[model samples]
Target: MKKEKTIETINPTTGKSLHHYSYMSDEAVKKAISKCHKAFETWKEISPKDRAKIILSIGKELIKSKEELAQLMTDEMGKTLEQSRQEVDLCVAICNYTAKIGPKELKTEDREMVNDNKGRITYAPIGVVYGIQPWNYPSYQVVRYSIASLMAGNGVLLKHASNVTGSGKLLEQIYQKTDIPDGLFTVLVINHDQSDTVITNKLVRGVTLTGSPDAGKNIGQKASAALKKSVLELGSNDAYLVFEDADINLAVKACVKGRIYNNGETCIAAKRFIVVEKVYDEFRDKFVEAMSNVKTGNPNIKSTQLGPIAREDLRNELHQQVVESVKKGAKIACGGKIPNGNGFFYPATVLENVKPGQPAYEDELFGPVASLIKAKNNKDAMRIANDSRFGLGGGIFSKNEEAAFEIAEKYFDTGMVFINSFGLADPAMPFGGVKESGYGREHGGFGLKEFVNIKSVMYR
Candidate 1:
């Protein structure tokens, strides 16, 4: 008999194994998929109001278990306890927003037809939706996709990252406590080969993933081969533009927070800083100083502003990127070297004089590393910001809100943009990206329709 494979969950702050989980066998995975499909059949028949009630209960449950959930997230992924708590709050807000608005979003619409006939459009539930999520913001990542899918009356199947496996199971437990139907939400503990098999399963009607562009391409191909709908939220090196009229102090503070949030592992985190020459020196100096002073330590401590990277391998990869960028042309302004410590800790790093050939300028450095670039003017700042191949999210800082809005609306190529501030995802706004940042929008009301079938009916 073949030996069963197991995943070990390690504490990023302590570099010790906290738990281990056995991978579900191929037979079990198939059975789980079958069960999800069966549940979807029943879930689809339920009224939207009934679905909303269950979803609201889930929101309440999340609030009730916020402390425990936040601790688990911090223990498994090394996000600051404060940030983890905010993540849980964000998840609850998502659940609340989806529950309140989902029924209306999915309600049937009526229209008059040209041939003296009545036409109606209905949002119909698809079968099981398979999601492959990342470790950063473990709770929020799963909640972002799952709640919206569930509110639309579809079953959800999660293949969370190996490192945060415990958080995944905890989420499943929370859902089970709610009034949601059994098998409607399932977490599969499986390897890559088994994941491919799950995607190829006939019952999985739609697939969504949050990861790198390379992974997106591979998953897109697999889903295409199976004729399944896919939504990809890929990685990005998002840029933040600072205009000449920007408030240097506020810009520096926002940029620092943006760079270091979630240990700087966020996909939408501000990675590039393109500042106009008029205020470049002041902004760069202050930004580097602020980033340099950020406190890095155990995530459980409230005083610790920055936490360790989620994994040792990830820390090494980020260091390699910084080193290679320096070799090309970039100059380390502050905090480039990995700290001498037990945990996977790297100090907040800022790379200045960053040029096109450097990894800091060309690639996504998924850590607490900031790349600072100087431009001649506002036009040049926008140009530098739009030069990247990825455009998940970006930000602009200027005193004139009108001017910033104009540039963001007419020129910024990213999916979402912040004026005078930096933020993560919002439940009311449609979030996703254009170009290589992947396709489809989540949150707002758009997510409820991503996996639903738009059926048309006509009566004469």
Candidate 2:
């Protein structure tokens, strides 16, 4: 496939052109990689404490430009302005968290050898790590990996989604405002083929991606074939289980927030709501009512609860999923309609009688659409939650905290689980998923080591 010469970003809210960017040529990308590798030579020698100092400054810079950055993300990807601000806040939190723990996490450790010789383990910075990120949570997705990798002394490169190209360039500018080196945190405005060339570059040591499973497979394969390490945080159809003993009101409220937050374009958003037969009718009634009342309109408005779907094609794809699911016997209790308007708006939809062999039940509906599945009992609810091929994160809502914890730990078959709440990534806690949702973890000090070379040295 031939690489395009230019990339254009459109405003999803208005469907108008916001900016046009020229893709970096192959020579430009190679030079960028070489520059990053050169910077890495000096950056890798810096102490973790010094790196944390710069990272701390980055957090301050992010807050200083929070409003501007937030608005740019809103204009680029159709996320609500307030949500964009919150995304900036999350990025700041990640920066703060990475700075606080990075020094200790990346510090060298002394250990005893088998023959009683002195042994030391050093977590050294690898070369430039390339990240291919999605448009959803643009700031958070970039900051999530870049901050940790920078703190670990590795140079960072980004290939942000084309729809959020402005966000990516703005982030690069934000990083430049801090003490970070020039090429240490660079954003490549290149297409897919150039990205492949980057992965094969000898200067690129590690790769990480946050996208769909198919994308993960492609990048993972390329990185593996090149013998470079990769970390993937793929998509998920996270289930929010409402057990028989669960509080119907609390479950409904949290599930609704989980589904609709970020306009329901989140990777870990509660897509599946599995309710026990005992309380299915009551929960379904209240859930459908809440979803029906959700406001959908311009993202800039303060009162809008749902924004445009980021792109026209994405909205159309979501509608097709709803249509296919309906054909497979799923019934739309509320929403499920694409609005006849200028913007790519998808209503907060709910599908009931959701069963296997339906897109609503099998695959991820990456929008404000909910799949309400009925389980015979608590055991059956667990079974349905664990039935999917993707296992990123899930939730177990029950009044008995202990029982929910046990389920989260023992039976959930996911990376992270919420007991009585619906929450996204936390800087203090480890985040990532298992199975097709992608391997490896991010956040909570775990991400700091993902791109580091753990070297062992012995002295006799």
Candidate 3:
């Protein structure tokens, strides 16, 4: 297997060089998987309590090393240092959440199997599990799969995003430094060829991917060809709906967090804001002012709220998307064009008069760009929000709590929704999408199940 000395990792914030990592080869990937399989043998023999102890130990180590991990992520992918730190924190919380609680959560029902038998459902390992994670939320995506896979007695093979090779390496460092068993978790430095081999390996019983729909389809199909269970979390065009009765200030703030958090690179970020026509002007004014106030620059500093697009092409692509949207008649309120500077920075842009026919109406914009749509009323807002094929998450702001829940029920494909607030993430909640946003969840109990098998045992 061939490997490189290093892949160029540029800081999107200032276009500075942040050197780290060479890609691993197909042979390396295979070897790593073999190691994972070997570890799984011994790891599976350990009690869930013991595994929990190891996991909790890893969490404690994470807390101690949080700053270094966060700084490494910032250097790797150029998100704000604070954001990178937060991503590390999210990983720590996940490790803590899954470790302290997973052993009990995996417990089965103690019931008789009817007149002559005892029955119980057991959560068991499914061999080595392969996780193909993306660049956005690097640590979060890694934890989303790794924590559960480790907790459920399975080994893990990680093939993280290419742009985030440093992050992948950093993860390897963190897990390796902790008490967590060595081969139970391995981050493959290998490229897709190795990733492909790992996916098809007999040792890998299951695979989960957090990427694009096309990538998900290809990986999913390959996994199916190998007869492996797979979970796909593609992308989304999540909507943020605001009603006439909603709190403008709060809704506007949440909307900013939803869209601008992670520099608007989240799959669950609010892509479209469907607002009631009665308050469209107010919402637009406030949203534009807020977006304009957002500062996009150095990721290592404390005051920077938004950073660069993770990569240069991504920034160019986002600029093109906005330019194309404007050509299709979507008005740019505050930050329409790229800032007159170098590096991959696109000022937060707002799209007004975004309609069904507009290009921005259809796809996910992976930067600090958001589209605003006007609706006649609650029903109209619902109609607009539900108009897209992707339904990963959503938000609705209404004074009426019952009305918010009622409206929430009306959203057929939404996995998570925020009422009178913004859509954010929680380790306790199940997160995923429907339609093009992809199927399956990546957090909480459901997330744990994605990498395991449910075995029903019975005895007379």
lDDT of each: 0.94, 0.92, 0.83
Model 1 steric clash pairs: none
Q: Can you write out model 2's per-residue Cα lDDT over 235-303, one digit (the tens) per residue?
A: 999999998888899999999999999989999999999999999999999999999999988899999
Clashing pairs in model 3? 24-189, 113-117
Please identify which of the two predictions, 1 or 3, would achieve the higher lDDT against the true structure. Answer: 1
Q: Give the least accurate 10-residue stretch of model 2, judged by summed lDDT.
A: 1-10
Error of 2 at 443 (Å): 0.7
Per-residue error at 180 for model 1, in Å?
A: 1.2
- Candidate 1 lDDT score relative to the true structure: 0.94
Which candidate, 2 or 3, would have the higher lDDT against the true structure?
2
Supply candidate 1's per-residue lDDT for 460. 84
**How many pairs collide in each candidate, listed in order?**
0, 0, 2
So what's the TM-score on candidate 3? Answer: 0.96
Candidate 2 positional error at 217, Å: 0.5
Which candidate has the top score in lDDT? 1
Runs off by more than 4 Å, candidate 1? 1-4
